[model samples]
Target: MLRFLEVFAKGSQIHVPVGSPLIRKIPIFVDEHDVTAGAMKLIKVLRPAWDTSDVKTKLFTDGTTNKLVGCYVEDSPEDVVLVRVYGHKTELIVDRDNELKSFQVLHANGCAPRLYCTFLNGICYEFMQGDALGTQDVRDPSLRRLIAGEMARIHAIHAHNGCIPKPNLWIKMRRYFSLVATEFTDQASNVRIQQEVPSKAVLEQEMAWMKEHLSTLGSPVVLCHNDLLCKNIIHNEKDGHVRFIDYEYSSYNYQAFDIGNHFNEFAGMAELDYGLYPSREMQMDWLRVYLQAYKLFSQKGEEVSARELETLYVQVNKFALASHFFWGFWALIQAKYSTIDFDFLGYAVLRFNRYFETKPAAMALQIPQ
Candidate 1:
């Protein structure tokens, strides 16, 4: 059994003005275009005594949306902080206030890194020491257990004041749909949208289909990482645990949706290959571990019955379809607004194609009564 421990440092006691209870509202703003310069300024505010000249910086380029830079001194590398500059117009897609609340909640429970402070357009936080799990790294059985356990721990978190959490999926997807531009300003993208993207009417119908069909599956609404891409999982080999990063999409959602979303990510983003999507046997094994950990964390009976596993299996696979539709539309919106150098339209096509390909079988899955 993997034990959840408080390995991360607490949020820094930066006594700045109040924005929220958990975040220090630092008025400084960082530009995504000039990440290095912006990162240096934030680091100075966070660490005034440290020698700015000797500070070494590393730009993490793997992220598709935001700019990430690590600032640290050679002698005190353990004290490194990550500077994350929000991508251009990402606020249209991401709810920044909700993201901060999610980060604070997770950090308090020791499931995430401490959030240092918030800037005008970004955030600075502890740079966790771990390898961001790659496509193949996630396939390892040992790492898979850690990922399952960590996810269960996150799902176990309760909303403040003992209030029940409402599922954000339907409303969020609707908001994304509303934000998606009808026609792109870029000629090439405009043409691609016209030729390849689904009509708004079709998208609306599919959204309704997901809500009507999947809503009755009886999957519990819990805190979800909503976007558990391979890159978002950080595994520390030394600590023997995994920590999930990037809370931009974190919210109360269908528990099976989180697991299914993660399983979909086994295909990866950069070089997407749905062929790598986990097999039934692999999913069963993963779900077994997750159910056990989830039971343990939630203080339920740890023993998982065959029916319990089967029900989750059915729910997760079906919800995987919803994941595809969610991100496919998300990619379409990103294509219109993002300045990132990735094929957002192409990514959208892959997701939509997979959604249709897997629809019949996933919809056919029935929970063992």
Candidate 2:
């Protein structure tokens, strides 16, 4: 084990033993709240040399599928370490490869954290030291403009042909709905409808709409950070620069998708329960900033007219509805098969209701060809 540990001296190997009592028993200093025993064990095996007496691990709160944990080795100055652990498997190996590639691309474009090293099973990057911009921070006009500018710059970078292929939106939507339907059928008795989950017939109609629209929508391929939630954006006070983290869902897609997705985050769709949805006026203001920045930074310099912007806005809502349905179904399934308690079906139904209520005006905004 010690011999194997030597190869990990730089903290770049992934196959190190994790969860073993022997691994846990290894004497190492760590911050109480920064990491789990499993994370620590992995860190110890691939120990990166630092002048600090001990290392601290701070688990970030923004993860769904994979555990996103940060390790900070405090020498005279603190340095950040980001570790993404996908469970042990061949799939994890592929994930690590993609993550490393994405990290490199983002770093080269000056959009993300500096890559330190990657283990075949996980990834580590130099920690980004800054305050994460919140809803309030994003509300500032200057800050919003800056963020918009950065996002445009990121999208301007050209991706290799099919390097990040776009997924067929309708196919993906059907898969999402199927997952939900399976869950609903299995737990029919437990499912409670808050706003009425869309009937299979209605869902099929929506899916058909997505398929038709997707085909008509021109492909404006660009490198996109598809998941640009506000939390993924970090602001460095020292340099007054904003950095993006998390590129797991990046791909080549329509520029409108990226534009609309970021706008959705600014719209505060995720925190609708908190009554944080932006006013129509506010939404327009954000759109203006985003479009201005996008035009300035995009290599194509394509001017997006107000009509086109509005149409894309409506399309984004459609995408959001699809996502809500998918998650709703996924949650329903998990609740059925696993020991988790949450009203996913109810939430999905609520989102569906909200979509219908807002869809008319949003659709009205679409540019008539």
Predictions in order: lDDT: 0.85, 0.57
- lDDT (tens digit, per residue) of candidate 1 on 83-165: 99999989888878778878887877888798999999999999888889888988899989899999999888775344455
The prediction achieving the highest TM-score against the true structure is 1
Which window of ten consecutive residues has the lowest lDDT sum in model 2?
A: 15-24
Worst 10 contiguous positions by lDDT, candidate 1: 7-16
TM-score of each: 0.92, 0.72
Error of 1 at 33 (Å): 1.5
Runs of candidate 1 exceeding 4 Å displacement: 1-21, 184-189
